[model samples]
Target chain A: MMRQEAMGVLARANLEELRGALGAWPEPPDAESLRGPEAGLIMLRGRAGGGGAPFNLGEATVARATVRLSSGEVGFSCVLGRDLEKARLAALFDALWQREAEVVDMHLLTLVRERLAGQIERTAEETAATRVNFFTMIRGEDE
Target chain B: MYVAVKGGERAIRNAHRLLADKRRGPRNLPDITLEQIASQLALSVDRIMAEGSLYDRDLAALAMKQARGDLIEAIFLVRAYRTTAPRFGFSEPIDTSKMSIERRVSATFKDLPGGQLLGSTFDYTHRLLDPTLQGAEIEQAARADVTDEDRPMPRVTDLLAHEELIEGDGEAEEGAEVGDLTREPLSFPAERDLRLQTLARGDEGFLLGLGYSTQRGYSRTHPFVGEIRVGMVEVEIEIPELGFTVSIGEIQVTECQMVTQFQGSAKAPPQFTRGYGLVFGQGERKAMAMSLVDRALRAREFGEDVVAPAQDEEFVLSHSDNVQSTGFVEHLKLPHYVDFQAELDLVRRMRREYEDRTADEGKEAAE
Candidate 1:
């Protein structure tokens, strides 16, 4: 079996182009149609239990763009928050990310991931500070 | 408002709110601390950590608290947490030989080195409740205060090795030879690494029942607990960039080795057999049960016929994990409306065809 390291490189590269090839909102995707929440969920983390340690607060709301290739494979990319430009970029990549797309190259895909990663980092600073929540302990009868 | 069945989103949100409210039943009560669960409910946390394949006592405790004492749910929480946590590096293979033993015992010998320190076992304890624990004056036992430096532990394997009774020679299996269970789907006729990996994270109850079944005349093999060891082992990680091994942390582990009596064959010498088991934390019953099942799984090695259910590797390993079993079972409750609608349409068509065939036969007879 091929080590996981090889598979990771393939998935990341494929996903970027796959997410980018998806174009504008007017053009409906050819295959792999979906009807669900446009905004995806991203888990934001906070200090674990009020200075006790670090842990996940909960899923943060984010706008995601998804599109399917002509061959019926779907790709998805979620941004930090509701950035329409980011969502469009994600959509374009989603449309072109597949191996069969034959239009985008690996070099372009790498550039897309780097660009997306940068955009995400910038937007994350603003959104991360706002939605911090700590779950109160839920009591049971035995307690 | 002529909308047709459009309030599902609102209804789902409201239902979640109600569930949250119900989860927090009474606000007046004092909160249960993670320490309390870690100390008092240690067994449940141990099982959770074992099945979840992540050994964080505090997180396991939190999972238990969140799960409302359901160990399986706690295990699920721990598993979810495990998935999200980024993998920094791999830990060094724990040296069971150098384990700082807390509870050690052996059934193979009447006496052995390091002495069978029955140390903190519930085996001899009466089932009767101690009313003193319920009193307000409940205090930590004096024995609890004893430090690790005061008493050192020696492995039971060392004793067996000392006498040369056990087969102690096997090449160290390289890490590259082992398959990663978490990353890939398991295939049939798995290697010992994959099998042991699955059993290590398998559900306690499932393994226990399967292990028990073997004792009830299913490929019966007279087994003895050659050794049972429990203690903390330091987790080490090799840094490729740094070119050295570094200690990450420590985790409590329970290890069991069972020696089964195997009859001699024409080609091979008759000798005592071995079955190995290891689990996170102090779970003797699970470890012992695992050891028995592990041995049973090695039926092919002994040239024995695979007539028993426990001897079937697929049956034993596949069903041993509660998380996988329960998840697949419960996933049936998810939206299957599409599949159900298709089935319904097929059944209606079949009935119509059957009625038409019977009518044609009657018409032919009349003609």
Candidate 2:
């Protein structure tokens, strides 16, 4: 998978999910924080009219980190909300993915994707029931 | 002699203890967790997020819980917390067309592509409260099997734009600066961009009242709910080090596109106009109200008479923030002994002068 796809999934992965996926390696590769597991705010922007000029909507708390493996690979991850541990783990995962994409995909990336996909599917299914069952209020007025 | 009042420290401490007791609401009952407030009281969290100008649901929930469910106080808490965080770069403008929609509806069309989905709304429900819901174990909610196809839900306004029956959005120039209310104060006759930013964080009730005024013939906007969609949209920001954009997880948003009937102008032909609103959660009511006020405020742009309070940009923008309004209004409850004494002394001197003048007039009349 591409780096963009990998980072998106890693950022979304929960702490439990990341830790569970980390269990794959008998002994994890040592990673050091190159930048931050620091939490901050990312101002979110929106279009004026859904598709127009952008305006600042609000800000969301985000935690971002950069981790470099002892070898050479460096990875960066920025995720929504302020879970510093999650940010650090995501960064580590990103670095690992750069080194071994095939292994990370098998253990972590696919798991997060499948879980999120399932959630979206469940919601879409539930919402499908609510589609308006419309019939004409007046027979001639339907025209 | 000027005197200072003191010794509210003990009273203030005791008052806080009482407030804590009230927030907990009897030790016999389990306390409401922040998680529960985040999820179960989701609407309150949404309102707090919109008004607080922050998008963290967990923080919003904690604020709500701490403020004992007083939403204005909750929003204040969130705003206070927001000031401490460092600024990361703003995200790319969200594409609502790509939203993973939960609810989509339009009053303008009965049958349209991607039929209306009224996902989890209170609109049609009987207002009668169900007593069984009080501590009753809830059963399985209604669900249906859906096709795996992820169909593109085209906006109704987009279709109208194709026929040239509606005024196009007049999309902003790509490199144009969008206004930031938090960063800069608004000047008079502010552009549409700044107005939208203000409305997004403006008090929902204030917007609601203004929107209602228009319908009551204060502004007289013939509005039709062109579309209202509640869903999640991906947010992406460019990282300087990476030299590319990465998706930050999605945020749930509500967007309303209101179509208002427009009369033909001397220079332009009559076409439907648009009022838009997008808020940080399932804030349909807020979105709709915002849209109404937005259109009303756009009266000057359309060369229509700006006769309404909503149409007055200064009036709307000046008083939109509840936090600012509440702070100034509530400050009256604070000690103002010096101010009161000054006013009292002035009034006493004025009365004494009036009596002395009256006595002199009586003496002159006796002479």
| Candidate 2 chain B weakest lDDT stretch, 10 residues | B141-150
Which stretches in model 2 have alpha-carbon errors above 4 Å?
A139-143, B1-7, B148-150, B357-367
List, in the given order, the native-contact fraction of each candidate.
Answer: 0.00, 0.80
Deviation from native of the Cα of residue A64 in model 1, angstroms: 32
Against the true two-chain complex, what DockQ does each candidate achieve?
A: 0.01, 0.80
> Model 1 Cα displacement at B226 (Å)?
1.2
lDDT for residue B365 in candidate 1, whole number 0-100: 95
For candidate 2, give the DockQ: 0.80
Would you estimate the TM-scores of all the predictions?
A: 0.65, 0.96
Worst 10-residue lDDT window for candidate 1 chain B reads: B141-150
Question: Could you say which candidate leads in DockQ?
Answer: 2
Distance (Å) between predicted and true CA of A74, model 1?
46
